[model samples]
Target: MSVVTVRIPDTMDHALRAAAADAPSLNAYIVQAVRRQMTLDAARKLAAVDAQAALDLDGEGDAL
Candidate 1:
């Protein structure tokens, strides 16, 4: 694994600390958050592609 540095405002840092109180470590919390965001983004992209495919199919039917 690679290490990356992140900078955040003091207020956000405090919030993150509070949010991670129950977490094993700040890094673990951030990793979990990043993974969740990645999954959500992937799902959104897939939904957009499926929607476009449906629209393209509808257009093909109209052209026939």
Candidate 2:
């Protein structure tokens, strides 16, 4: 694995460390957080696409 350095606000860093006290490592905690965010983003995008498809279908029904 490659090493990446990031600079964060001290308060945020402290909060993360405290929240992640039960985690095995800070890196693992950050990775889990990022993965969770990605999943949430994907779900949101899927919902938006489904909503648009519903709207399109409704318009089609009106034209029929």
Candidate 3:
């Protein structure tokens, strides 16, 4: 529920607005994208803090 200000290159801004056309708002699109990236990053890590099995970030074990 906080507002943030950021700066980006003009080309990137153009692309972002085009991509966000289907989203309810530019802010919502960015927020969703951030959440998805964080989820993928966490999924690639060593293990969950609750003692769950690792999800195979090291290019070895089979993922669940």
Best by lDDT: 1
TM, every model: 0.72, 0.68, 0.63
lDDT of 3: 0.79
Query: For each candidate, C-alpha RMSD in Å?
Result: 8.2, 8.3, 7.7
lDDT of each: 0.82, 0.79, 0.79
Full ranking by TM-score: 1, 2, 3
Candidate 1: tens digits of C-alpha lDDT, residues 7-57:
878879989989999999998999999999999998787667765455445
Question: Which should have the higher lDDT, number 1 or number 2?
Answer: 1
- For model 2, residues 1-64, the per-residue Cα lDDT tens digits are 6677767788799899998999999988988898899999987876777654654455455542
By TM-score, how accurate is candidate 2?
0.68
Candidate 3 versus the native: TM-score?
Answer: 0.63
Candidate 1 lDDT trough over 10 residues, lowest sum: 55-64
Model 2, residue 43: distance off in Å is 0.1
